[model samples]
Target: MNNLLLNKRIVISGAARGLGLSFATACAKQGADVVMLDILADEVHSQANLLKKQGLKATAWQIDLADASNIKSTIDNVIAHSAQIDGLINCGALATGVGGKNMMDYDEDLWDRVMQINVKGTWLLSKALVPYLKASSAGKIVNIASDTALWGAPNLMAYTASKGAIISMTRSMARELGEDNICVNCILPGLTIVEATAYVPQQRHDHYVNGRALNRKQYPEDIDGTAVYLLSNLASFVTGQNIPVNGGFVFN
Candidate 1:
């Protein structure tokens, strides 16, 4: 609403629903031209249409983020659509469902798939988009991480490991991209109750809520301000940092 991002172009992954959609909406409200990428083609296009109706310049692309070749083409298309990209929000993730398996019970294929999408996808997508971000004097990259990566959740080995890699990547990207005036950071979100979490076992949900200082589930809105702040000029001095959007769930 303050027009902090006016005339800027932003790209968000996983913008079909949940936190990613929230980020897209917020950026649009601040007058940013947004391009959303998601595996769910119909849902993403519908959302983009809605944003367009609201007078925001928005577009949608469907792509499998796990493949490096696909990521390169997707990033190139986005850059071609908009002369420059000012920010990127890597909010897409996978491997959130199968958590009850122990080390022995975990399937190798499942583990590999998790790492491929959650870790490799984020890295490749960021790498592919760096050139566009670098073209802008004020560029920012925000990767969405999870609290599970902090303390580590039992039976969630693959998801935790991938998120931990995201945290590490954030710092490394910041260091490498700073010279280009692009700021890279990570956001650690807590138990944000979205449609996806409905599939989570009740016991696990209770476990997360009880551990939080607020003793409540987090909502998509909880991360909005933090996301905007990190991408705004106010955070010009901030880079290689991790800001937990969880309700004090994990103190670091």
Candidate 2:
């Protein structure tokens, strides 16, 4: 119990599995009351319950990123129950239709769905929660992006583009919310080996691992420390920054 996030109330999207679940558990371990929101209702609830059994403050909610009404209603419900929100981790994203498809061959509907969920969903959720965030003494937002956007990986145009938008939006949000003392930043991860990414091809995984300074694969745990720092008081002065946790894959 490092308690780095003592007394803070944080909300995490896509908290059922993969990086989202990792972040939820990490925050809870640091003494933050976490609200885990995911489309996978049962898995998320079970995860929260497991944390509770460990004597951590954790709750779960189901949400669909594509539905604006659902996002607003879920947030409202969270506020009604949690009363205040101190931080937000936007890890929810649609990465489907991203691999092995060039721009010319990419399906229109798939591209639209990816953008709608990854870009628009992130914006809407942040916009809807800004009020509660502003009410906190130290409000912070961490937008999960991908290093693919920085280096422009091949065959993943839509995913990379949507992440690019997230980086841009993080900058804009930081400037806009600076007046309200809300800090916003983006985290660009490399090819992390999470369950959600288990489908990634072996060659792709090797490419990421071999190109890294660490000469190893990145995992969900590799990102947890930076996330904790960003949401902690230690990073109050840090905003509008894009920090890559990709084991030195792309140096900025």
Highest-lDDT candidate:
2
lDDT for each candidate structure: 0.88, 0.94
Residues 1-252, candidate 2: write the lDDT tens digits: 399999999999999999999999999999999999998899999999999999999999999999999999999899889778999999999874467878899999988999999999999999999999999998999999999999999988999999999999999999999999999999999999887687778999999999999999898999999999999999999999999999998998
TM-score of each: 0.96, 0.98
Q: Which pairs of residues collide in candidate 2?
A: none
The ten-residue window of minimal lDDT in model 2 covers 94-103
What would the per-residue lDDT of candidate 1 be over residues 97-209, giving only the tens digit for each residue? 85788788899998999888988899888888888788888899999998889988888888888899999999999999999999999999987888666777888888888
Q: lDDT at 186 for candidate 1?
A: 96
The CA lDDT at 3 in model 2 is 95
Candidate 1: residue pairs that collide: none
Error of 2 at 140 (Å): 0.2
